[model samples]
Target: MSSHLLPNLTAAHLFEAILAIALVFSCLLGLQVIRERRPPAVTLAWVAVLVLLPMLGVLLYLLFGTRKRWELRVRQRPVIGCETAVRPFDDAHVLDRMLRRLALPPALSGNDIRCSWRPEVARRDLLDVIDGATERLWMFIYMFEDDASGALVLDALIAAASRGVRVRVMVDDLGSFGSLAAGRRALEAAGGRMVRFKPVWYALRKRMLNLRNHRKIVVADGQVAWTGGRNVGDHYLAAGKHEWLDFSAVIRGPTALALEEICRNDWRFASDEPPDSSPVWVSGPQGNACLQVLPAGPEYRDDAWQTALVKCCFEAHSRLWLATPYFVPDETVTNAVLTAARSGVDVRILVPHRSDNLVVDLVGRSFLREVQRAGGKVFRYKIGMMHAKAVLVDDTLAMFGSANIDARSLFLNYECMVIGYDAETVIPVQAFFEYAFARASRGVRTIGQIRETLSSLARLLAPLL
Candidate 1:
């Protein structure tokens, strides 16, 4: 054979070998997906993709399909078994029981809860907590920008550390990549500590790029706590064209200790250092509000938060109100909303007129239309980006925290939610909903043909997103 012919033959053989390897790998992934027993639609989608597009399918599955990571499985389990200091209200017995069965902490009374709707107020409340800390301060946020707002909060933390208060901050490596260096240098210089949750390079090396820490929580002295959708950024603190409307709650009581437990678990996972024991609750009950703290992520065996949310939709007796920045829900949640609205329960959903992501907006329209067809009302906020994630079911249950109504928040990321079961917590959340509803534009009952077709196409990719 000629020399050039031999080179070409070698190249062709290499290509064929690569193709055979990819085919075998794809088949193995398909079998693994089936054995996992996911939703029927999801399973079919994976099988089709793996069979038809072997190389691309293998890459996509490695990035997004895998649900659990080996590193997390080997890490320490979450701390539980915190005894409920007080019983939940009679109306909330069912929800309390459901959470208990999921191995979540029970609802406890004596929490003094306060909600902040406006950006300025939320910013003030956060600063106040940082400034007033006397013993220890812990914060876990997804995004921490290097803008003016971030500097203000960092300065406060530095001062707290200088004053002998233990301060620690954990931020998502990808979400806050732009400011991580500056934050780490400044905090460590001031005698504080900072760590990144699943750093981007580490996640990419491990083929777990899609997993993220999305929870935003701050605990001060193990007594006062704050958790919400707003991250530390100029858009979340300032009032301007780029401002975002969000919600946050400040809790002063035993519930704060529960929030601390969550922080400790996350810190341990990120830093691999044993967390300090929780401080003793000396002052006792702060008020009469009842609250439960739920932490959910891929680390858990089941989708505990998603199950609780679906149950809330089915348990609503008189009303169900949901507000979120994103509204792409899975089949189970979609059907629950449809059934609730069709059963004569007052159902309403509030979302931003246009969110930051175009694909999410298009995918959400199809889901929103289904709810509208079932007699549920939809409201689109027009004044600014609506970034709050809250749910109210009748007058007995209320939820507000970092998780949105989309698949990423519900199934992929680390999320925390505070469930309140009394007038003290529910009344404020209800008022915030009413205020936003009045400012938002009602969803039109119709859309153009081209838009409808685009939305339907986008719905096909919802599972991957």
Candidate 2:
């Protein structure tokens, strides 16, 4: 029983162990700080996973982060676009057929559409229309960059609300982070209300980081609705980045009601309020152009908008025009394009020669060979970036929205878009597409093509987009 015989633990050993634990905890805390403003729940979840299994937890988040950002289609259908224009809609006859194949109420044109070439112009005119109203203004956007242009829109909402207009706003956590604090302050000071969706802090499995609120719309008095690819930011609004080009469409009718429903759902979800059913949506008369709000979000139906677009792409009997900055398509969508093109559909894809997201551009290149082999032609816009997200099928049916061709737009983020089948409405949209097309150059992507084939890793990540 000699005390000297007992093994003595050194002070240095204890100190080293303490330091290691502190280091891990410090890393976890630092990540949370960097991510900032995620939902309190998300932040806590991250903490729990990391605390429980630090190294594995970190690895899991990295692998899944990219996938988590993508909104994957939960179901598939043969066709999804609603043909609304009576005279121009060749596909309207398929409504009865779709009732069984797609399980969606056959859509018909019930709204007036006004297309704007620039996102900033769209933003101002939309705010003006919503501000001009006395009843209510609902503004929902994925990104609200902290810049002068964003302030202008915020001020417009403010002035409207000051005059007794009920204004509600929703902004996503990830997109708004870099510019959120200032925007939030101004909104509060203006007597306007704003809520951030899914604020996740850095930890393992950061809940809100990948699932963004990507929908952009402004619904006023249930009469006018604005939807498109433009987020509220300098680049999208072409505020600082004069070269940035985007598209948006204005809607007025029962379809507008559907957009309003989406905005209401977003606002309520983002807000602190216990959601009450958005006052019974006031459906309007069937207007000249038929339209419907196809939605895809976590709280709502999954990838319905995406499924609709892919189906329409397959059904394109004539020309297919697609414009998106990011072109990373999941296999199902990629295969759909290939099938349509292989079947002799005249498919053309328009993408930016230089996009803000380089990885996305690379991921898009990862699919060129197959699309090209299927008789699809790809163009890279050289004049400026093409941020337009629209599709024209047979020059009859058309679509516009925040949805990108990439996995992020379809399955991961909250996306909203409109489908219409009016030559009256779509002719102008087609003309707009042609204008952008004229400025673009046919891509001779030998380098990109080879690289794409070599880099199977990127394409493997496509479904997670």
Candidate 3:
């Protein structure tokens, strides 16, 4: 054969080899996806993508599809000081029992729970908690910007560290990249340590880029704790006119110790160093409120927080109110919400008119319509970006924390929430919801054809998102 002919033949063989490898990889991925037992829609989507676009599907699966990371789980230390001795299955409240069964901390009474709906109040309380830290301070925040609010908190942390307080900070690498450098250096210079949760480069190398640490927790001296959807930024602190509507809760009791344990576990996971010995303090009931800390992440076999939230929805007899910035719920949660609404429970969902994420906003419209059809009320906040994640069931239970009502939060990211089952906690959350509802416009029961078509298309890609 001629030289040109031989070269062409070699190129053709290389192309054929690539095709065979792609086909084999796609087949293996399809089988693994099925074996993972994901939702039917998600599984089918993955299978179809692999069958049609094998190479791209394989890359996508590696980056975003892989859910479980056994290494992370193995490296994580066991529950140190948060586990309950006896199962609370016979508890009066079904949610309490269910949460205990899921290995969450038991609800402890006598905790003083204070919820802050205003951004400025939450910021002030957080800074005060930091400045008051006499022994140790731990913070696991998703977004720690270098703006005014961040600077203020960093200054507090630096002062605490300078005064011989053990300060440890953990922030998401992707969420707070380059924003924490100055803070970290200053903190470290003052005898503190700061670490990133799943650094971007490391996550990419491990093929776990989608798993983010979205938890926002601050525990000072193991006596007081602050947690909620609010991160460390000017927008969250209401420094500007376009502030995001958010809230955080302060708890003083054994519940604070539980949160501190979570922070320690997270810090250990990110820094690969065992947490320093905790200061010894008498942890007793501080007030009349009962609170439990529910933490969820990919390290666990089941989605504990999602299961609890769905259980709460089904258990709601009088009312169920949810406030989330993102609302792309999965099938189980959607069904729970619809069932409650159909059963004559007052089901109301509050979301922003337009969230910061355009795709999430579009996808959420479809889910919101489903709720509306099931006799649920949808309230779209119009004043500003609603960034709070809160849930109120009946007049007794309230939950608020970092998890959004979306797949990424409920399934992919590390999240934490405080569940309060008493008048004190419920009343404050109810007031927050009432305030938001008053400002929000009711979602229209009808949609135009063009908007409905776009929403329909967006719903199809919801599983991937």
Candidate 4:
């Protein structure tokens, strides 16, 4: 019948139109990828997703594959020609040369580093420093809760602001959205400035839901700074039922100026406020610690943390000990660790037994067998969640800050770490590792059937973790 033929023709035309639209969209996406010029592996992965999954793949890419904002990129351009003004104690180490090549501020000596592993002690020190702030106070925390401990910090900031102290607070949009209104209102009402770093709505609008500023930095009066894995919250500070074993370092010296500069750059990027180019360099050395600050994130063309960490693994002749709550290292890191361990390096990785992220916990377990096979040791902390992020190489080198041993931290998140080549700074972090190792249960190559199955499935999605 003519009527049936017409209906069939119409349906076929509609299907053809849909297919054409999809093809056009895929081509456009491919072109955009080419323009961005990402790494071959990342580009291929994205292209494969687009080709295989069509609309859904494109949607996922839109949500997660975008780069850092143009504003941030522009702001960081000056670092390219920035000279390393400070100098390290030993310029002989290959690490120092690598850092200098990256255009990082020189490794400065005469810095004092005090580390605290106990939650209450760390919080006490943090609050004390805040209370003692005189000139300027800047805090960039990923999570700023309104709970008991958080309230104390907030009140301290408010009081400091009221007393004419310059205070600026920056928190991650998604991580601390619940505290946004209250925190801003409390701080602004007291004359302090506050801004959310890359708000979630901004990310959604820009189709960039993956990048987050996860740094926890506190700089007071440009004289001292505190930073590490701990955020501003009751769980991270107080002795709660589910307390975490966290570590923070209080640093004083010219290194504090380096930390203050990091906070200033981040604050200016988020607020678009006039740059604070005021010098905060100390007139004299505060101690004898040699420290180099490494600020890593998606803004840079190269992954600073990844490069440094890989070099740290490969260059270690004696020992390499690392600790983090998450351990989903990329293939490069994994291979480097395996190669180093097999070469008789005392490579050890410490992770928490009970992690805050279930997927990360499961996926982390999958790497244990391979590491063990390479003669490396994996230790699981039985003590509450160990949220410390630290690295110890031999006896003179140590690093600690907000980075994790995972793809997200290494390549996605805005993170910072201080690399110290002095025993004064490295010794405490090494001691902390020793303490955690003493309380850790050495990894077994096998696990229960159910967990093993879950972990196997989780490891399949490790790249996304």
Candidate 5:
């Protein structure tokens, strides 16, 4: 019945076959949209694309629209070392409960936190801690350039490993691939073990490329840890054309254990090796600081860090100061900050005068005037690129981490931050913000002043950036 009919089939039959295939794909995609149960806007957008451009739309959705596969696998498969490392205090608050429910350790007290904006100071602190490492050292960095600054750290790691210390380094595959081939070899030659997280490979899932390990963390002997926006590069530590003005917080006490756990978890995920079962603990309360190490990524049910930051903005009674390198926030984030400013909470955003990303800079420019109109103040740093990601709410809390105020950091990449709830931590962060703000210019011209057509077009494509 089919042999002669297939040969005799005309253009009309071919067209009907193509239409039937498209209908089948469109229906399957619609079923997926309902099954994933994403936000209304996201679901509608996918449906619109599928209806308009059937073939290309299905391909793009399959590549990037799929939920975080790696995250889902990690969450569903319980690793042997996923145990509670810290105990909650008696007076645990709402934030503490929320974090605990997410499988994070309790916000422990008796912690010491130091915030430093000076790159040299932070670099020295990092080196000193590494040099002091006697037992074990673990580092997770997004980028490790093969420059003078990166050499110093790599040399330290090699020396530490040669001296019988156990040192482990995990770098993002795509970000530090060049550096691994150039400078990081010495550390491995000296007996240190280094692993790349999710290395780039052809035919690998497209969603895996975006789900990078963006956390910048270093732990020494399970007693001290350093985390923030600074990467191992000359630009972060020295003054140059593209040098960044960044900050890192040195954490001590029980909080350091929390940071260690994050490193252990990530290392296991990348290497498929069992984490060290030995627990990291402190003697007792080192200081009055109370801190929690919050880790967020696509793996979680919600964007925990983004939700926490927005919650902090709304809860601020006096002032909310946020300084970030990139300022491409989603509508939800923008509205939260705007509502705070409109409600008489003094809101100030300090972004770099010139960002490293041109498209990101343009998108940020589009929001400056609107935020300013809503009672928030926008200041552009007059000096070098400000790469610090920090927020201060009144005199109570100070948070600085690897995540920026951009779509990628908020939604896609894995990020980590230590939130301090004591004055000792907040005071130093506030002081740093004050110092940077003094050098920033308050006379920011709106996007309308800067050329509306280009900026408007950039703003419309913000989701892609």
Candidate 6:
């Protein structure tokens, strides 16, 4: 019926096959060379996938590449009635009493911030006040494992929702990739709303790998709030039977208003329903505490946390204390710490003895030499991963929130932090420094020489962690 047409079709198919095969082969080689300096195992795994399943492999890499932060461009409406709105708490004494919830500075730009290290205490206190707020609840987490303790938190929220609380939860789709879908189903069935951040689909539209919402925050009654490193997973509270050292806090007053605003902004960007803090919590007779809320993300022009830390370190009158699970120092941070130590400032850094991410762990160790040489002290927690991000400056200024001392925290992830100038708060935070140091392993680096030959190359690539 058509020998000529059949021959043409055959020729076209053969050409298509050759071009597709050749294209994939070139992509595989390119990935290999680009990853030549990475850990051998990591590079090999990356190569194998791209070569064996070029389409799917490239898609996977684009979704979860070696990027430290990931985000999107979405315009957001400002929160009205934001507690952070400039206002005076009716009774100076009353506002001061509520401000006591936070370790505030004498004053703040808009609102103040207070930090609580007792994760459970913060959660319980916030919930007690949220008991009858049957309007709404929203939460986001980087990870959500199916564990008993995690279930407990879920149950509580679900119970609240059942009682007419509008509960909505969003989890990092890629972070909890390996979990069974049934886990999320439980929340959905319990009258809670659930969604995943960037679930993988077919190919294309993948390259935005560096953006991730590593923020942990909870808002109840749109008045009280909690934000920190504590995710909704059980391992955070030792509920997974392997709880190590983790920290979080309860922040209220004006700063809490900003906290609520920030969370609502995020929710708006994600679900297209911008949040409005109508009748938002207002500052009452709170103590005269100076507190500032710090929130940063990919769209931010400057890393506020990093700037504050650098300032704190350089201005330390006597001592500085920092607790972080990961430690990947950037140039400015490294210099500030060094200068502070050299200036006779007692500088102490607490990092997890073992880190969840190996790449960052090595980079942290790599910077030890320079830190010690400058008279700074580096201590590794022995009991467990020291997952507390606390910076007590001069025993007079204190900061706590989601940001770490690492580059990821400084520039990559969506992080929140609060700084205050209060001895009452800073003193308690610094007092615990000794206990942490007691449980930490001092670095082997000699004074002034940061010899981290072990991971120089790794640190070089960490700009991508």
lDDT of 4 by residue, 111-137 (tens): 788998888988988987788899889
Q: How close is candidate 3 to the true structure, as a TM-score?
A: 0.93
In candidate 6, what are the lDDT values of residues 328-383, reduced to their tens digit?
A: 77777877888888989888888878878876776777776567777888888887
TM-score of each: 0.93, 0.77, 0.93, 0.90, 0.89, 0.74
What lDDT would each prediction earn against the true structure?
Answer: 0.85, 0.68, 0.85, 0.83, 0.79, 0.64
Model 2 earns a TM-score of: 0.77
Which runs of model 2 end up more than 4 angstroms from their true locations?
1-108, 202-206, 238-241, 278-286, 448-453
Candidate ranking (TM-score, best to worst)? 3, 1, 4, 5, 2, 6
The 10 consecutive residues of candidate 5 with the worst lDDT sum are 74-83
**Model 3 weakest lDDT span, ten residues long:** 74-83
Writing each residue's lDDT as its tens digit, candidate 1 over 1-465 gives 598699999999999998899999999999988875566778899899899999889988887787655356323233343345657446457978888777777787778999988888888899999998999999899999988899989899999999989998999988898676876888889889999988877877776678899999999998899888889998888777889889998999888888887887788788967756544442478888888988888676667678888999999989999999989888888888999999999999999989898888888889999899899999999987999999999999899999998788767888899999889989999999999999899984578899889878889877766
What TM-score does prediction 1 earn?
0.93
Q: Candidate 4 — worst ten consecutive residues by lDDT sum?
A: 74-83
Residue 182 error, candidate 3, Å: 2.0
Question: Between candidates 3 and 5, which one is better according to TM-score?
Answer: 3
Residue-by-residue lDDT tens digits, candidate 3, 171-209: 999999887777788899999999988898888888778
lDDT of 1: 0.85
Could you report the Cα RMSD, in angstroms, for every candidate shown? 2.6, 8.2, 2.5, 3.2, 3.8, 8.1
